[model samples]
Target: MVKKKKGRSVKKNPNVNLESEELTQAPHSFIIQRGLGHGHIVELTRDFRKLMEPFTAKSLQEHKKNTIKDFVSVAGLLHVTHLCIFSQTEVGMYFKVGRLPKGPTLTFKVQNFSLAKDVVSSLKKQLVVEKAFKRSPLIVLNSFNSDTAHMKLMASMFQNMFPKINLTNVDLNNIRRCVLLNYNPATDLIDFRHYVIKIVPVGVSKGVKKVIQGKIPDLSKCNDISEFFTRAAILSESEMEDDPNSHITVNQKLVSRGNVEQGQSAIKLTELGPRMTLQLMKVEDGLLDGIVLYHHHIHKSEEEKLEIQKKRDSKRKLKEKRKQVQEANKKRKEAEREESKQKSLKGMPKSTVDKDSVEERDDDVQYYREEVGAEPDKDLFLDNNQTKNDVSKVLRKFKKKKNENFCKNKEDKFERNKQKFGVKRTTQFKQNKSRVRNRLVGKTFNKKSNVKRKSK
Candidate 1:
């Protein structure tokens, strides 16, 4: 039996990285539906991620336990510029686009939306390809020329979501997708759609175009080559009727052949959608919070606005005062630490002064050493090795001197008694001399207790 060879694994290319100068400067965002999410909203977030494409965090897997702050905290390090949050409520689905760190957030009520899979399923042919999303989609805005401040801001934000193109040096082949934002003044609603760009030959029939495209269609149903031209329905069902508005003569070559000629090329767009219809509900001055700049549903009186502003000012001032107090305390602690450290270092070299004070009484020993040049008597010095000189060590030295005198006197008396009493009396005197120290200590204790001892 022959062994089958294992197929080689194909590694997917990494997403647009940090080293790319153009991508780093461009606005990047995360489509987040953190915390709890409903079924439609979770799927909606997934579909919207596709619309963001290679520049955005395409592989960001958010947990229900995760929070907005978790993403916000790291957004600056990753150079993320914007945050898109989708949430569903009992009334409707809401979408928020907030600038990172500090933000003027735009909140929209999602009137309706269709997912990408649903859009593709409705079409006769699916044009969703991995190659189409390799580069960011071109953004085209319509009816955004209104003088309203919010409208201008919305237009600017939408434009910045996609990277800027330098048409002079940009490759035509990489321009594969586009996003269209059409605003309607009548409804005050925005229609958002994504599209895949395709350039096809206008003059040629579907059969010849297919041959040029290198896709060989089935010929079993066709009787002859002429039948392909004669039969109107025999061409692919996915083929769309050519629109005159879509046709444009190309000045340069394209990725596809036969569409490069000046008169032959036509640009067609297929809906690559997760289509959205949104109505701006509110606009905030900060990241999802702060002062409300505009609100479609709310109106406040002049007095109320003034009162709110005064309260906010008071709170801000109080916070700043507390911060100053904390800073002052921190500086005080650091100063104290430095002071203690300096005091310790300055006091480190005073050991010589301490030694001189401890041995003040030993001046005689030093004088003899210098003048006599002889070894001093060991008995003259006190044994104070373990600790400083104490009363106990002094008493011990006095007792040794006293005992020496007592021993000499007793020996002389015992020698006199021994000469008169003979050898037995001499042995008894020797034993008494051995116990003389113990007998002296007992006699002192007996005198303190007022007791008499019979001494022989």
Candidate 2:
């Protein structure tokens, strides 16, 4: 038997906090698809992940068998704060935005959606590999300053989904992408749009812009570079004018050229779609459940509200009572376990228990001595030397002899059987081995049989 080496026991202190502020405060999300999602829905999920950028699980592969608990199990370890779950049903597509651990879940019915590929296909020219998604996108919430509790709560929740931007230290060059959530009060819908921010110089012809951007103009048809610009009939596609409303004067220097300080720069938005037209359906407390905070389709009377409040109160009270009971039961079991452990330790062979108990390991002797109110004349325990001698004597007695009656009865029983039946016990051709088997094994019939005939 191998002996086990005892190692040092270490206990962790729960109260001592060691996490940094950035990890605790920064918002991280997991965007997942539940149920059956395919085709455009899967592409749309990928687009949404791109929009979330660096803080999200980019390469996360979710299994169909994964439940909510699987994600929740690691949420705390990863400091994930939000869950964006997309699921499809017979009714339509649904989008759920839930806060982790506990939540006031927001459910939106996707009225319509357009994938990023569809947008790129529709556009004549658009930048695809721009490093805009390296950092988080700038969140722009428009017309969300509503006075209602749910509206304010939603606005706040959206704000918290991204890291709190420091205006003073923020780099102007890093803000390359923007996410717009425009709420239309008239339709009760939110228009979601993602765009790549570009700055083009104002009043510059596309030809001149191309030349300045290091693109060699088509001078093969012209004698010189000046003639390429001089040809009146050779009006290139570059002469088309741009939107005047987009022209804005640059306040700061940028990493991308054409946006000079104190110079006019036309801000352009190339829509990087996976666009969604979402209508608010419902909002509930504690992760898609627990309590209904708001409902667009449902309305209730004052009496109904009061009844709901009472029921909620009753449920809370019952939950608290159950929690208390469970805690008490756990403590009681722990105490009982500790007490039994101590008792077993005290009654151990090497412990302060009596010598008789250590030798024989029986508690009855101790009780007998207590009952008599004195130590008995004879010890209940046998000495080591005497006990060894007694054990050897018993073993020798058991090994001494076999019963003579057993051998005598065997022959008597065989003879009685032959006399009772009145039949002759004759040896016949009782071949134990088959002819084929005997030939294969090289055996002969003349060989002596182990069985002996009875003497006359």
Candidate 3:
């Protein structure tokens, strides 16, 4: 038999936690800001309302209201204009609060000026790439939400222009025709490109706001307005990528939902009560069309843990069953061994032969004594009482039987002789008579012969 190595097998706990501690940390940010441009903000808000209307149809309107309120609470209105107000400030001095998703939320003193400069340069690239000189305003998309195929094609086209980039998260939004790029000097950030288009309010004069709003702002120029904001907002977002500990902050408003507490940059009890907590986190790069952020829990792997536990329990049960079967077999083997011993002991001469031999000897002695006592001639019969009696009885029976047999044989012989020949008694009488007659004749003849001789 080959000897097995006595190495211990390590068993893993399936319930071991897979979620990182980074998920537990709430979103932290250097600043908090609300968007400006109240009318556009309201329009965005209306868009959110329309999105949530469908969700409310499934339940009491309160459900939808809570969701909206929660998103606003965590992401802080989720209005791009509001977020822009903070972007206007210098890069270092933090002001507004930002929500982080899967990563950590951090508070940092703005340490680098190049980070701000990079943001501006990233935005400038958008206009140049889109070729904004044309009438049909170009559309720019952030690398975050770009489709893989399109991203790859774009990457190939721009291989000589820029480094390789991944566009796995992209999907075409309401706007079309865009360039996606990753441009972050401090932290790698996704960016979208197009000529900056600004929507001028009905009342505002054509000045700095108008200049920022761009040349043409109208329904026909809606696409342009979208592209302009896409570039302007590029610099607004400040994400910390160096700190594996840091996460991007975002608002839930774009998706038209409430704030999340578990994975967001900040964790806070809702105004409603302790029943729920509001969470805020960034979902994607700022230049991406969709709002950045989500609300979810740091969920535990419950099902896997239960499955592991069940497996262990089943293995234990199987082991116990096998042990029971082995024990029963052992008992049965022992019982068989015991039974075999009993069988061997049963035929032992000590009990079957010796035990009975002793009894039989004693019985023989008693039988002899009884025979002696029963006999009348005790002295003569003592030595061979049984043998003598047997012999005498046999002789007497033989003599009596022999006499009976002789009589029967003589009768049978006489009967057979009478049948075979006539009687002999009359023969003797006839013979005597003949002899007397013959004697008489001879005497007469003799007298006659004497007389004749005298006469001569």
Candidate 4:
């Protein structure tokens, strides 16, 4: 082998142990001068395979432990087109992400102003990018704000952002250019000859200074504008122009003076007397002619007149008969009512005997017999002094007692027959029972009672 240099030999085996040497070594001049400053050198010892190892195992139990807490499944990103900010408070800002047809709406709560701003900016950028990439037309409609100046400002901003797209107002079609025609009120008729004509180019100002300084006049006061403009336009053309070629004029002179001859006579008052006589003769002649032409005309005979009188008399008699029948029916109804009252009263007690009256009568009879030491007359004892007030009081008491007895009997019958009839009784059964009871009571009073005749 060739002999190598000592320096080369030492450099070739640079990994040789140096701790065994006793000589002290000084720090590097670069490190001392920079005072712990390191050069801009980066070291990368990344193992991408080792980093992604946890995500590689799909069925790993430990990885599955990291569950999603609050997750919302987005059906489609395009459908989430509307972003509405509902509220902004100290705690957080609330907003909804939704669209028409009202599908799933996602509400987001952003914590800070900076974060909300960033999120809104990102959303706008995404929307713009999506619109551009898809090449879809966008229509912006605003109805919440009515200020025209604010609307114009918004329109300018939108135009600046979407330079390639067409921007128009929602009511663009409704905007109209109304040209008010000048009117001359001095003339009663519409004067078309002196109309002030104006032709304004689209998007060009006639007088910019005047427009800026002038106020918008009320259109309600300009009713004659349409009529004036129409009349002016129609009458300004050749159709209304006077033409000498179509004009015609005539002139005439009398040939001769007519002579007044004495052949024809003028009408006089004296002639009217003979004319009236002739007219009277003509009227009489006309009447005679009419009578002769209609000779077969018939006239009413005496027998026919008599027959008409008889028919009138018969109609009067029929009306009187009908009135008499109606009167008889009314009287019969009154008599039937009286009879019904009498029948109803016949069943009621004639004289009511109250408990106090009965006791007083008994005490009076006993006192009279004891004091007189003889039996009192039966007729005098039985007869009590009766007055109109006493009769009314007796009637009232009798009515009350009858009503109480009737109600008690009705309730007792209903209770007794309620079980015999099933669980319920129909209205027909109750009505039939009432009708049968009324008929039986009416028949009971009609029966004649047997009485033994005493020997005279």
Candidate 5:
């Protein structure tokens, strides 16, 4: 009686129920999470993103994109040989996935560390699945703070992540020793990029202690250790020529011991000790790298030695020929200078007969005597008589003309002197009158008296 009966209300359902029984449903598409986290999920559908494939025309074309028209993919099969990271300010990191050695590299830029980490993780997984890690030893070249504790941390992380592969630091020297890759660390950047490791061929020799047996080789028997070394060097050079791959590396201690007086005489064998090692030369990245260690003498064949000697002899002969040619040229030049001097003196008069001219005259006389069977002395005398007569006549004429010119010049000079020094009668009279007037004026005479006296 105190409360009215509560009215029950029905709750409305937001979901509508179909009246018709026939229902059509869309097919469900399944998605597999790559464990790349939420940040990388969108990368799955990127146009440039692709999975590595075996090298084939179809596969290569399929992976190619028009977005980057200038991009050139690696020539060989697409494989992930290395993982590299670059630090950037605007973007957190830039990663590169290298292909085989000398092949093209693919790159991706990430704005955050988390996304970069996921991308790298995903790449490593793919590499493992493809068995790319097993083909070659993986070398981790980090350009990041090498002296800091962070490097150690990064190294540890890489080791833990890539346990199946052998991860090592980037040592250019050591790498050079092993391979012939054309990589220079001093001038090259290694940060934020993966490099395909090109293995080098290198040979390491045994320790010095092992190479030298009981006592050092005796050098007393030889006059000087140099002779022995010369023989050994020749032998090694010949061996190297025979085998292009062969190299020789001699230890300094062995050389010094061979030079010692005690070792020189006692050493009988021509070859090096058994403990030495000979390594073959290997090419890396189109470059020759590494050294061979050896402790023995490898001589060349007699034929090869003879050929070398012949070549040296030929070179000597060529040099001698060149010297002879130069000497002949020098002689020809001297002859030309003499000829030019003679031509220059041909028209000029001389006070005395030149020695060269005398020699030439003698030669001419001898030639006339031999070829014409004539008395050359008599002919020369007659020629001189005629020439002397002509010269005397020319001198007489020149002297007469010179005398006439001298007389004429003397007369002209005498006339000029007489005109300059002798005074004229009229000029003398004017001068006398002016002088008298001046004297009368100085004596205080009147102008009228001076005029009257001058007039009288």
Candidate 6:
């Protein structure tokens, strides 16, 4: 055995080695491993796997695709690389190399990833052969911005291709080259070339529309790219007036027809884009027609009908509203008239009477005084005999309104007496009402009833 053992045997039992693997396990260190808390690694691994799943073998190697790699490269230059999962367009798994920042993180401009991928792959492969992309990220951005629907479709396709992509890996910074193309079929030339088409909410581009309208908008005050787009224009007067962002400007020289002149406005496309144009088409009850690169939506009759309908609707509504207001006013007026009639009835036969008139039968005893003998104070007349002071006191408490009736029978009798005597006294007259106070002695019936009535 000693003689045979002279040669050192490196081979060991596979089963024994496998069993010892547990004993000699690799040492785990680093903060990531130290207090990883149970299952943290599992969770991290799961997330990493999920993140990597989106960059599939197919996605990365699809040479025929308007590859996401090309989009990422162009977007990286613009510093908007955060659009990896498409869902994480704002923020996600962001990786940076050194500090000489690359480009935009996302390229939503490319219509079809597959087509773009083909072009990019071919170009990249050729570039690689030429050693062009070895030092630089290939920045290719092609924008088919005329069709939001198309762009949305493209986004869906990307989502389908990379369903498991981790949204957290998205970056949105370092935007690079941007290519914007609006192909006009009528002229067969691209319109308003702005390669750097910064993405923003549609609302932000409203100001750009105004700018295109020759309003010379305050670009310095712009808050975002959308604001710039909203205020942007086609940079030509004829194109500025055409609205709804649907019309395509054509150089008459490019597509010359006897009727069509250079720099002249043409009915080649709709004023508004697809959405508005579609709505306009429905109004005309006609199907939309597509041009080579631009969309030509013909709906003149529909437009006229819409205007007519709008006017008719406005008039109808106005008439209805006016009728309602008139009815309300009529009711209010009727109510007011009824209330006034009732108020007139309430003061019927109202009176201001002298206390002595209830007892006195002789009209000669009654007296009404005048101020300064000749000046008659119309408001101070007494109904029966009463002292000036006494009548004054009563009149003070009971005001004589224009609607009051002051015991006209007594007044008539007094007038008769004056006529019979054929006398008009120039001196101030006064009568004593206390002498007729004896009239009230027999008026009361029961003390309890009187007290209750008085309380009421």
The regions of model 5 sitting more than 4 angstroms off are 1-134, 138-230, 235-456
Q: Compared with the true structure, what per-residue lDDT tens digits does model 1 show for residues 1-456? A: 999987654443354352677767988998988434666788889888888888789889888778789999989878799999998777788999998889989999999999888899998767877898988899999999999999988898888778888988888788899999999999999999999998888878877777788887677889988787567886555576577887787766786866754666778888988999999999999998888878899988888888988998899999999999999999999999999999988885667766865576478689878998996887565434424456767788899989999999999887888789988977866766756766777743224435667998
lDDT of 5 by residue, 108-171 (tens): 3442222323444544222222232222223343443455442333333333222132235432
lDDT of 4 by residue, 1-456 (tens): 999756646656766554332111111000001111122100000111111111121122222232211011221212222222123345533333222223223333322222212333443222112111122122233331435442333333222221133244222121111111122223211110101111111221223212333535333534664543333333334324233343322121212112122221111011000000000001101211211111112445678757866886798899999999999999999999999999988875545645556778789999998899988885554434555557788899999999999999998887778767743565558766776787787843223333558999
Q: Candidate 5, which ten residues in sequence have the lowest lDDT sum?
A: 271-280
User: What are the RMSDs of all candidates, in order?
Assistant: 17.8, 10.6, 38.6, 53.1, 41.4, 38.2
Point out where model 2 deviates above 4 Å.
1-24, 166-169, 231-239, 337-385, 389-456
The candidate with the higher lDDT, 1 or 5, is: 1
- Alpha-carbon runs more than 4 Å astray in model 1: 1-18, 61-70, 89-91, 167-169, 233-240, 338-456
User: What TM-score fits each model?
Assistant: 0.70, 0.70, 0.16, 0.14, 0.16, 0.16
The models' CA-based lDDT, in order, is: 0.83, 0.81, 0.36, 0.33, 0.36, 0.33
The residue-level lDDT of candidate 6 at 211 comes to 53
The parts of candidate 4 lying over 4 Å away from their true place are 1-299, 342-347, 350-456
lDDT comparing candidate 4 with the true structure: 0.33
lDDT of 3 by residue, 1-456 (tens): 999877653445554554344322212111222333232322322322222221111121222224322433444222211111121233222212222222112111222222222333545332222222222222233443344432343333233222122355432121122233343323433232322331112222223233544545443433655464444433333421123233323322222122232223321111100010111212222221222222123333767657756886798899999999999999999999999999988766655665576676567667777887752434332324456788899999999999999999998887776566534634555656776787788833334333444564
Per-residue error (Å), model 6, residue 191: 14
Q: What are the clash counts of all predictions, listed in order?
A: 0, 1, 34, 0, 18, 60
